[model samples]
Target: FWESLLMQLLLFRESLLIHLLLFRESLLIKLLLFWESLLMQLLLFRESLLIHLLLFRESLLIQILLFRENLLMQLLFFRESLLTQLLLFRESLLTQLLLFRESLLIQLLLFRESLLIQLLLFWESLLIQLLLFRE
Candidate 1:
């Protein structure tokens, strides 16, 4: 019975770890997709602005230059922010995984201790029984 329970606990732990891994992967993919979409949008906006400037001549050139500079600044800020978020998320995931591993180790140790106690109890009972039979 204890063995069966232990097996179930192990299986549960494996499944939980697998789920956490999948969740972490999905989060990373989502962040990557978000960053990619932002880049694509920036490129499209820049191309549209360039086309407008070409059609309008010098009048629009000044505005286009300013807009481009501002856009670049914004992009730089956004990229930095995204990078920071990614690093933070990665660190959080690592911490969670480490904690889960520690918990699993603790649980396993407890299971082992319980099994040892059971074995000792069984031995003591057997010794008592033998003495009674001899009497």
Candidate 2:
């Protein structure tokens, strides 16, 4: 009976050592899986950041193009407005010159009429003096 009990105790110790080794191996596998999951998460984050950077660059380019177009449109509008003002100024100057010409023509006509009336009065007075001398 003593020999049998000793054999059973040795067998039990060996089985317990094997169980401990399996538990340690399972723990190592769990740790390795957790590290792999963390690496995958990091890679995904890096990819997301790169995508965002590309999008921002594209947006910046579009904004620059829009601003240039707006500036060109404004310049065109200014040119058109300046041309219109110049035309209006030219028309106004022409109108003033025409009015001055009309006034000069009217003044010349009035002077001519006054000279004709003075000549007629001189002829009539001369005729009356002749008739009195004959009588």
Candidate 3:
């Protein structure tokens, strides 16, 4: 009977040692899995941050392009308006020059008519004076 009890005690000790080893192995595996999950989460977070940064940069570039386009449109409008004003100024100058030319032509005609009248009066006076001298 004592030998049987000794054998049973040794078997229980061996089984306890085996159970302890398995528990230790399972605990190590669980810790390693937890660490791996944490590492994957960190990598995913970093990737998301990079994506957000790229999107922000793209949006900023688009805003700059839009501002430049608006500026170009304004400059174009300004140039068109300036051209129209210049054309109007040119037309007004031409009209003034034509008016000046017409006035000068009318003045020249009046001067010629006055000179002819004076010549006719001088001739009539000379004839009368000659006739009086003859009488």
Candidate 4:
């Protein structure tokens, strides 16, 4: 009877060890599956974010173009008004005055155009920095 009890105890210990090892393996498999799912979700979220960023950039580009067009139109209208002034003063004794005003206006407009170009360049650099930061 003593020998039989010792054999049963040994068998029980072996079965318990097997069960523990199998349980550990199953847990590891579940953990791996969970990690894979999380990684896939992260990738999908990143792709969606990229799409949104592209759309936002497109809209901003369009708005900047429209702003540039509006500025150009305003500049053209100003030029036309200057021409009208020139024609009106052409036959008068104020030729020197007219020339001085015309030259000054042209210089001012050129300065404004340079300033706008600088501002646009600033915006473009800022946008590129933002995009780089995201990556």
TM-score of each: 0.53, 0.54, 0.69, 0.57
Q: Please tell me which predicted candidate would have the highest lDDT against the true structure.
A: 1
Query: Which portions of model 2 show Cα errors greater than 4 Å?
Result: 1-11, 94-135
Instruction: In angstroms, give how far residue 102 of model 1 lies from its true place.
Output: 0.5
lDDT of 3 by residue, 1-135 (tens): 999999999999899999999999999999999999999999999999999999999999999999999999999999999999999999999999999999998888888888888887888888889999899
Model 1 stretches with alpha carbons more than 4 Å out: 1-56
Q: Against the correct fold, how does model 4 do in TM-score?
A: 0.57
lDDT of 1: 0.95
lDDT against the true structure, per candidate, is 0.95, 0.88, 0.94, 0.93
Q: Report, for all candidates in order, the number of backbone clashes.
A: 0, 0, 0, 0
Query: 2 or 4: which has the higher lDDT?
Result: 4
Give the clashing pairs for model 2: none
Give, for candidate 2, the lowest lDDT window spanning 10 residues: 114-123
lDDT of 1 by residue, 1-135 (tens): 999999999999999999999999999999999999999999999999998878788767888999999999999999999999999999999999999999999999999999999999999999999999899
lDDT of 4 by residue, 103-126 (tens): 999999999999999999999999
